[model samples]
Target: MSETLGRRGFLSAGIAAAISAQFAATHNEARAIEPIERNGQAKFKYSLAAYSYRGLLQGKAAELTMHDFVSDCARMGLEGTELTSYYFPADVTPEYLRDLKRHCFRLGLDVSGTAVGNDFGHADPQKLREQIEHVKHWVDNAAILGAPVIRIFAGHVPKGGSADDTHRQMVAAIDECC
Candidate 1:
């Protein structure tokens, strides 16, 4: 059975996990994150983001792939992992996505989420539409990979464009992406 969470639920889990990881790292403490108890059961989980291995994957440190990142997280005993989209090859196919998901499943890790870099501040309607389409494509891939949340960001405002206008454009682009 697929264990994918809904977007909102996954966002909540991913954010809490990220904050917990940061706190633990900076404080040099054990995994002391207190779980949110509900009916005497823990509600939150801890995860490692693949982006944390960016330098290694991008050739700045050591050679690695997303699969290696998953293995490292499993070795570190994380409960979930965020598969950052930046490290994926440009021509990623459905077969590749299926393999990735299967690998995570075999390692007993949740595909916490994925992320994309986008600019929705373009003044040109065509450009904005293209950007939305690009994001939508990733959304489909995320679903296929059993990932619940796909984080997207509105880039810096275009030169001379008003913040209000950019904000509206971003909203429109997001709406279309959804």
Candidate 2:
């Protein structure tokens, strides 16, 4: 009668049990770590960055909104986040920014930093000023979002401009920002 029960059912049951046992063992191993403590006090730490998800937000390819990206980070056990400027909609308002912050808090995520792509090395003063103004706005938004760092980029040199001139212009633009 035992032999007639067939080998397939027994093999399937054995495999399922083995998989379940492996999962349980892994869970137990994870739970075995003692809570981090210093001098009998538990310490909390957080880290996250926008660049970590750049691949998911590539040009014209991103399917997820900024909020969704943040949520995904939270799901991954991250306690902090950095936002890229491209993720923001064109008509971002103060209320919208506040809502974003509130959403992060609800998800237990902190806004650690912001990244902007403005470049201020143009030869035309007006263009340079415009870029600077754009970057300043981004910095303000970063502050509003509770970001400690705001990344900016140096503008690319025109084809006719020498590398040395471009470097000088970039340095001047950075000085202007300061």
Off by over 4 Å in 1: 1-37, 59-62
Task: Give the per-residue Cα lDDT of candidate 2 at 159.
Answer: 69
Q: What is the lDDT of residue 166 in candidate 2?
A: 80
Q: Please, what is the TM-score per model?
A: 0.74, 0.66
lDDT, candidate 1, 56-148, per-residue tens: 876535599889999998999888999888888778899999999999999999999999878899888898888888899999999989998
lDDT of each: 0.86, 0.81
Each prediction's total of clashing residue pairs, residues at least 3 apart in sequence or on different chains, is: 0, 0
Which residue pairs show collisions in model 2?
none
Inter-residue clash pairs, candidate 1: none
Candidate 2 lDDT by residue in tens digits, 1-178: 7775778789989999999999999999988978666776565756566666677765676877778888988998987888888678777877888888888989998887888887766878798888888887887888788888888999788768788888898888777766
